[model samples]
Target: MKLYRHALSGHSHRAHLFLSLIGQPFELVDVDLAARAHKQPEFLKLNPFGQVPVLVDGDTVITDSNAILVYLSKKHGKTDWLPETPREAANVQRWLSVAAGDIAFGPAAARLVTVFAAPIDAEAAIARAHVVLKRMDDTLADSAWIAGSQPTIADVALYSYTARAPEGFVDLQDYAHVRAWLARIEALPGFVEFQRTPVGLTA
Candidate 1:
């Protein structure tokens, strides 16, 4: 398997973390976002959306970080991680949606603004982040993981950017549950530290 990813992308980091956790053997092919390599014709053939973290398993090419997580967890993870029941599956999907939707637009976007020095509406991003964070805090108030007691792909999907949200200027100080959750995820076996790049890269 080959993973086309940018070193600075949180989305890419999720896949890298999952692969490492599962002890999956794969090749890492760096995608030079600095050179706009992902937007070029060759890279687009791998993913029309022109994004990093594209996974190529032999002839099957998968795009989207969450989609790749689902594929990988179903294929390589223990049944506990993916689950078999519909309600359990829905719980997983719910958090995955939060990770990909709210978290992506909120904390992730806010971080990008600061990291890239992009012209972002700071007030708007903060408001967006607060809404999501409040929801997360409330959701985690009575649960250990996003999808019940055990960690699942949903937790993996949100771990990277959400954990480093402070770097994006969305402080986690107010979200105690989130902070605890972050620590729990980090303590999992095979957990790997996220790679950090020199600041000022556009995502």
Candidate 2:
């Protein structure tokens, strides 16, 4: 398998993390975002949207961060990462939605402003980060993992951006359970971490 991605991209990191956890032997092909390599015609063949974190496994190609997580979990991961029961599967799906929606728009967006100089509303993103963190913290109040008992792709999906939320100037100090959840994720075997970019509060 070959993974094309940028080093500092949380989306890319999530894909990398899951593949590592699943013990998938893969090659990393870094995309030169500064050279606009993603927009080039050659790169567009892999992902028409010209995005990072495109995974090519033999003839199969998967794009989008969360989608990559689901694909890897289904194919490479043993039953632990994605549950078989209908309710457990649906519950994991719900957190995947949160990763795509809230985590994407919240901490992920906020970090983009500081780290990538993206033109987004930082204050609004930070506010959304706090809201989602509170919800996650409350959810973790009784559970060790996000979806249910065992750690799933849902936890992997949310881990990168939420762990780096402080880099966006969105503090995680207040959400104790969320912080604890992050710690728990980090302790998982074969876990890979997102590289920290010194920006915003992290600067």
Candidate 3:
């Protein structure tokens, strides 16, 4: 398997982290975002969207971080990461949606401004980050994991951005539960650390 990714991208980290957690042997192919490598013809052929974190497994090529998670979990028969039961599956999907939506626009967007100099509303992104962080903290108060008692792709989906929310100037100090959850994930076997870039408030 080959993962085309950029180090600073949380989306890329999620896919990379999961592949490691599952004990999968894969090669990392770094896409030079600064050089616009992902937007070039060769990379665009893999994903017309011209995004980082495209996973290639033999003849199958998967795009989107959450889609990559689903493909890997189902292909590897890691039902523990992706439950088959209707209710459990729905629960996991719910969090995946949050990861793509709120999390994307929130902490992830804020970080984009600082890390990549993206033209986004940093203040609004930070505000949105707090809203989603509070929701995560509240949800985690009653459940060990975002989807349920065990860690799932949902956890992986939310991990990278949330763990580094501080880089976006979205403080994690108030969200005790979320902080604890991050610690729990770090202690898990095969866990890989997301590369951190000091920026925003941390700068």
Candidate 4:
């Protein structure tokens, strides 16, 4: 399997984290997002959306970070990562929705705007981000993971952006529960740290 990813993208980091946790061996091909490599004809053939974190398994190509998570979990994982029960599957789906919908539009997009200098409505973005963060805090108040008790693809899907929320100026200090959950996820075996863009890349 080949994973086309940008080192600094949170969405790519999620896929990398899951592959690490599952002990899957794969090749990493760096996508130079700054140079617009993702938009090139060769890369566009792999993912028409021109996004990083496209997983190529033989002839199969999967795009969208959450969709990639589902594919990896089902293809490689033997435990509860994908889950077998209906309720467990629904729970996983719910958190994945939060990760894609709220987390992506809120913290993820806000970080892209501030860090990458993308144009965004700063006030509205920050307000939406805070609301999503509060919801995450409440959901994690008495639980260790996002979906239910165990760490699933849902947690992996949401972990990267939420862990780095403060980089976008969304402080985690106010959310003790979320901080605890972050710690739990970080403590997992085979965990790899998300890499921030170097000075040159950000410049």
Candidate 5:
């Protein structure tokens, strides 16, 4: 398997992290985002959407960060990371939605502003980050993981951006449960650190 990605992208890190955690040996193909390599014709053949974190497994190609997670979990038959039962699966999917929706526009967008000079509303992004963090904090207070007692793809989906929320000026100080959850994730075997940039609050 080969993952074509940019180092600074949290979306890319999501795929990379899961691959390592699953002990899957894969090559990391760094996409030169600064030179717009992802938008070029060759890379477009892999993913016409011109996105980072495109995974190529033999003849199979997976795009989108969340989709990559699902594909990997299903392909490797990692049922624990992606439950088989209806209710459990739905619960996992729910947080995956949050990771794509709120987490995307909230903390992720905010970080994009600082990390990539993206033209986004930092103030609104920061405010949205807080709202989702509060939701995650409240949910995590009762459950050990975001989806349930055990960690799932739902946890992986939310981990990257939430852990780096502080870099977006979205402080984690008040989200104690969320903080504890981050520590738990870091303690997992084969866990890899997301490359941190000294920006926003971290700067």
Candidate 6:
């Protein structure tokens, strides 16, 4: 297996984290996003979207971070990282949707502006981050994991961006439950952390 990923990308981290947690053996092929390598023709063949975190396992090539997570969790992870029951699977899917939607436009987008200097609405992203974070915190007030009692792909999917939300100037001071959840994830065995970049308020 080969994972083409950029160090700074939370999307990339999502796949990498899961693979590590599952104790999967694979090679990391760093994509030079600084040189716009992902946009090049060769890299585009793996992922036409020109994104990092493309996975190549034998004849199977998977694109999209969330899709890759689902693939690894279902295939290699058996029913561990993912669940077998219909209701549990649906619960994980709900968080996956939030990870793609609110988490993408919110904390992830805000961090892109601060860390990469991408031109985007920082205020809007920060506001969205707060809304999502509060909801996550409230949901977690009763639940141990986002999906259920056990950590699933849904927890892995949402962990990266939400943990680093503070780097985007989205202060997480009030989100105590969310902070605790992040700590619980870090404490898990086989956990691999996303690379931290000091930016925004942290600077």
> What lDDT would candidate 3 get against the real structure?
0.96
Off by over 4 Å in 3: none
Over 67-121, each residue of candidate 5 has an lDDT whose tens digit, in order, gives: 9999999999999999999999999999999999999999999999999999999
Alpha-carbon runs more than 4 Å astray in model 4: 197-203
Clashes of each: 0, 0, 0, 0, 0, 0
Give candidate 2 regions above 4 Å deviation: none
Q: What does candidate 3 score in Cα RMSD to the true structure?
A: 0.6
What is the model-wide C-alpha lDDT for candidate 1?
Answer: 0.85
Instruction: Give the better candidate number (2 or 5) by TM-score.
Output: 5
Error (Å) of candidate 6 at residue 198 is 1.2
Worst 10 residues of 1 by lDDT: 194-203
Across 1-203, the per-residue lDDT of candidate 1 in tens digits comes to 99999877899999988888788888989998879999999999999999989999989999999999989887775668788799999988998998888888887887778776667776677678889888888988999887888888888998998877776777788999989999999898888777753442222
Residue-wise C-alpha lDDT for candidate 3, range 34-125, written one tens digit per residue:
99999999999999999989999999999999999999999999999999999999999999999999999999999999998999999999
Instruction: Please give the TM-score that candidate 3 achieves against the real structure.
Output: 0.99
Best by lDDT: 3
Give the C-alpha lDDT of model 2.
0.93
**Which of candidates 4 and 5 is the stronger one according to lDDT?**
5
lDDT (C-alpha, whole model) for all candidates:
0.85, 0.93, 0.96, 0.85, 0.95, 0.92
TM-score against native, each model: 0.93, 0.98, 0.99, 0.94, 0.99, 0.98
Which of 1 and 2 is ahead in TM-score?
Answer: 2
Task: Kindly give the stretch of ten consecutive residues in candidate 5 with the minimal lDDT sum.
Answer: 161-170
Badly placed stretches (over 4 Å) of model 5 are none
List of clashing residue pairs for candidate 2: none
| Candidate 5 residue pairs that clash | none
Score residue 191 of candidate 3 by CA lDDT: 99
* lDDT at 107, model 2: 97
